[model samples]
Target: MSKSIELKKKAAEIRIRLMQMIHKAKAGHTGGSLSNTDILTVLYYHTMRHNPMEPKWNERDRFIASKGHSVESLWCILADLGYFPSSELDTFSQFGTRLIGHPNNKVDGIEMNTGALGHGLPISVGMALAAKRYDNDYRVFCLMGDGEQAEGSVWEAAMAGSHYKLDNLVGIIDRNGLQISGSTEDVMGLDPLDKKWEAFGWHVVSIDGNDIDALIETFDKVPSVEGKPTLIIANTVKGKGVSFAENAINWHHRVPSEEELALAVQELQAQIESLDSKEEPCHE
Candidate 1:
């Protein structure tokens, strides 16, 4: 099977796993997690060079989940990658479980504790700057929600990233449009967001966040310029893959009922089967 096809299948499986985790926990940022699954899948599986066994390896690339509410997808990916026991997923959000609703630094493979809006980019900037100061080659990746753009700290970090010329820093915005309330534009106008980033002196690129192939291609060539931070505005559906939840604001943090979970899984399983069938046979 081709790498793209394999990643596509893996993304579908990740969506299914995240949905199951949310359903079981009865609390999660459903829409956002679903939207960002493809981006995280591409990063963990293909882009970032990190060892699951060595969670604190100094040379490994770091990822900060800036939009920390949507952490179900990340937890599932971490477990499946052997950073922790896959069985630990069942205790997500339960009493005493390290797998909380948000990304926790206590967990293996997690760089920092994040839940409050607008803090991730700043921390990521520090990590990236530290790398440059120490002459290390590690990169820092921060994933933020488009809604989180309203946070002033993000822009501050943006300016700092450029001023320091932290080309090793990559910031990705999950531009799903909808947030906890409603449309981001209605909440806080972020039109011409790309232009604003450019004005801050960072290289920006916009692409389909749900397209695995596009994600792979884009991540492979980072810091496209020699002395600027890279920002990827990943346009994605609010609830991708699942038919009923797509673009539905209620699904932002709403727990899926038993019936809804069943239907969502059915749709995702069909996607996995479709990708499996598309694999070309190998010949000697």
Candidate 2:
């Protein structure tokens, strides 16, 4: 299969797994997970150097899902990447299941158990610092929600990353605009977000988070500036790829009804077909 076709397939699978997990759990941050699916797909399937068989491989890259509420996306990607069996996704939120609302380090591929708004960036910074000190070439990637950027700890980590010149770390913000309550601007204005990161001495790039081409190119063009961490402010829609759910705050942590789930699955499948049609035909 062509690389584009493979990525499209991976994205479709990720979306299916995410919807299935959330529907079974009857509880999850569906909107945010959907919004960040493409980004996570690029990281796990295309960008990051990780080994499912040896998840604890010391030299492997680390990914921190800082906006832990949206962990269904991470769980889906982890399962797809062989961190765990796809069947385990059905156990999400069930009694004795390790697949809780937030990621847990005890989970095979999870580096840190993060659900709190601002914790992942700091933890990722620490990982990056450790890697640098040990002369390891591994990289650290952290994904934070735009709303989570309101947390003070995120800024603290930003300062530390810049001060230490931890170029090995990269932070991707899901700037999807909406939070649980309302739009992020109304909750807390992050206007001039790129400027803020730039002023913090980090390299900043902005892109359409849902665009596969942009995601692929951005990940390929990492280490934005040597000696400084790179932050990609990925502009996204809250409930991406689903018309009714898109930009709807109600889906933030709401369980989808059976009808809704069915429709969502159909829509996602259609999207996959559309992507397939757009791909250039492979020569025999």
Candidate 3:
């Protein structure tokens, strides 16, 4: 159908595939994977200038999944883009498989190893700063979790991004609220999140992260300020797209039971069909 509709369909397909991948393996950081899917979909399919065939091309943009536990979603995107064979998804999280729980540079599309939360932004900052030093135009993007924001290293990197004026770096916080333990606010409050980043000298924008159209528009208009890093506070529902899993903290790292998988499949199929009919708000 239309371009926007196509993006929605792509996201649905990725969600379906990633859930299956996790289900087959009987393990994954489920809630965060689903919550972060739409953002990864938009980045790989639309926003980022990356090549599956030449993942390491210097001119290509860089992306890091700092909240590395959610890598099932990223792997789905990379495989669909042909960075590697889709069959490899089946081996995810298995011993002797390259598709480990966390992303490592060994994977074709991965920019670096990242699973120790709160490191993505710092690494991305270094990449973006190096781009500036070399007078290159490549940009760097990092996706993180709200829980990871509690790390002091994140703030240190945030201050550095601002001080260095990394206009080419864009970081997105998957503000899904719920983390593995419980609600992020309950764990460690990050209220006034936007202002906190702004106080650190960032250009912050908040938006519905599940909406593909909103995601597209936001990414297109980033680096809105000159000489500043952009941090998108993406409001998202933990376990987005799965009826039973959505906002359920227990699903943070839980594997879906067969019944739960069937329900998720039914719900996502309905979503895909509805998009085909016209347009509807994606369930958050």
Q: What is the C-alpha lDDT of each candidate?
A: 0.94, 0.89, 0.92
Ranking by TM-score: 1, 3, 2
Ranking by lDDT: 1, 3, 2
TM-score of model 1 (CA atoms): 0.98
Tell me how many clashing residue pairs each candidate has.
0, 0, 0
C-alpha lDDT of residue 33 in model 1:
92
Candidate 3 per-residue lDDT over residues 1-284, each given as its tens digit: 67778988888899999889999999899999999999998898898898888888999999999999999989998999899999999999888999999997899999899989888999999999999999999999999999999999999999999999999999999999997788899999999999999999999999999988899999998667999999999999999999888898899989888888888988999999998878554678
Which predicted model would earn the best TM-score?
1
RMSDs, each prediction?
1.4, 1.6, 3.4
TM-score of candidate 2 against the unseen true structure: 0.96
Could you tell me every candidate's TM-score relative to the true structure?
0.98, 0.96, 0.97
Sliding window of 10 residues with minimal summed lDDT for model 3: 275-284
Better of 1 and 2 by TM-score: 1
Please list the residue runs of candidate 3 whose C-alpha ends up more than 4 Å from where it truly belongs after superposition. Answer: 279-284
Question: Better model by lDDT, 1 or 2?
Answer: 1
lDDT of 2 by residue, 131-178 (tens): 999999999999999999999999999999999999999999999999
Q: Model 1, which residues run further than 4 Å from truth?
A: 280-284
Which candidate ranks first by lDDT, i.e. highest?
1
